[model samples]
Target: MPNKTLRVERVTKRYGALTAVNQLTLTIRAGEVFALLGPNGAGKTTTLEMIEGLRQPDEGRVWWGDVDLAQKPAYARQRFGVQLQNSEFFELLTVRETLELFHSLYRQRLAVPDLIVRLDLAEKQHARVGSLSGGQRQRLALACALVNDPEIVFLDEPSAGLDPQARQNLWAVIRQLQAEGRTVVLTTHYMEEAAALADRVAIVDHGTILDEGTVDELIHRHTPSAVLELSREVGRDVASALSSVQRVDIQADALLLVTDQLEKTLIELVNWANDHQRPLTGLKTRQATLEDVFLTLTGRSLRE
Candidate 1:
């Protein structure tokens, strides 16, 4: 880990009466991947903008090492590269030409040819920006962000519109950036993306940090080691009495039993169903995941 830490101190942002980001504070170790995981309109983008120097915080500071970024925004612009959620480029510019244009903006830049090859856009070098597919355009966006060879990269939903394979490819590319010792910060609504890529995750909701930690730590904190689903609803009283079950999440069409001992709990449920002469229908078992963590914390689904 790098000795210097990137810090966001007591940041707050508001628009008239609506506060987008509350007094949020967190720190990132150099060369690690950190993610602000939340649903849309949960202040993830607003928080990122303040840290990126695209927007100033209403009352807070962003610090890099010992330097206060709020007082020296230009330094951040120079050392940090950003790939916005919506990146627009000249329709007629070729992939190579676009990289060249971005490279011209920075004093120190990488070789455009090497960047194109690195981003897997070697064959698409001659293709027009207007004609590229969604995945290709996203790769090009990442390529533009790297023209200056920044120390830190901020990606805003890097794989938003990509297909499954493209998303997987993008995830691999992000891992490569970490391997190169570049710090990566991203804002995402996808739990899988955060779980798949982030070293530490901050669960955000209503413009606040509900919880923050490693995926396992967060899940373990909630004590739901496994989730069991049933086709029928077991009344709250009956479900809560199940063996080794930590909690019961009752849904309209199904009942979810959150238990610590998966095998023992399933056996107890089966015996109970058999005693009542009621079949255990539509049963499903899954290990506790970040989605469960989010729901347990907020009383709502991550996608909702």
Candidate 2:
């Protein structure tokens, strides 16, 4: 078992009559990548802020290892680094100069050049913040977070808007952080991103957790069906004929059929196609994924 580095016990936060974060309890292990997943108003950001000491919980308590965050906020803040979803930086400052400014605030700082390389900012060390692209700015924010050489790090929506290649690069940097045995907690709506990087994930909705576990565990627990997709050409009639399937939907050029009896469904579909002289092209079968689990629990997709 991994060491529990951060613990939140029945913590709740509210803004007037609206409860942004309901009574929530969770633990983040040392050297693990834990993802907080939900929609825009799902209290993910509020929960993260509470743990990071930026906001106080109306009830319950938060502990950073053995230190009580409410009692000693400064100590808790020192133990962890944070990269907010949108942070303000001096537009006129060069990348190197920005690091120097942040380093001054921490008693123990990581090497500036080393952090830049780790975050893939080596070529942009002297580039002004105002001139960097969206991806470059994100990388710079990540670099700034590491200056403290913290035991744990919090990244809120680290990859919100970026090209595919840029997102891939940012993922590589996160993997590097994991390899160095730093506990990382991040919030994201991208299911694939959570699937790729998280050791465990917490699914939240309406200010509460619907499920929490490894990706496979959550999917298995919430989504029991297998997905069989076929080309649009033969999907309509075949879907109507699928007695074993619980649900079927059209997505672009493919048909998504959800069923527990995969073998029986496939055999029937194949036999029907063969008898009708209609070959089913683009036939693919996959197990239920995190997205399926999200839909099952929340009655909506994560993106919705």
lDDT of 1 by residue, 1-304 (tens): 3456899999999999999999989898899899999989989999889999988899989899999998898887877889999898998999899999999988867899999998899999999999999999999999999888888999998989899999999999899999989899998989899999999999989888999999889989975668998876445666788868888875567788888789998888888888888777778998888988888988877776
- All models: lDDT? 0.88, 0.87
Candidate 2 RMSD computed on C-alpha atoms after optimal superposition onto the true structure? 2.9
Kindly report which residue stretches of model 2 are placed more than 4 angstroms away from their true locations once superposed.
Answer: 1-4, 230-242, 247-255, 267-284
Best by TM-score: 1
Query: 63 in model 2: Cα distance from truth in Å?
Result: 0.9
The C-alpha stretches of model 1 lying farther than 4 A from their native spots are 1-3, 232-244, 250-254
With a 3 Å backbone cut-off (N, CA, C), the pairs that clash in candidate 2 are: none
Clashing pairs for predicted structure model 1, backbone only: none
lDDT of 2: 0.87
- Clashes (backbone N, CA, C under 3 Å), per candidate, total 0, 0
lDDT of 2 by residue, 51-165 (tens): 9889989998998778788999888666678999887699999999999899889887899988887788889999999999888899899888889988888999999997899
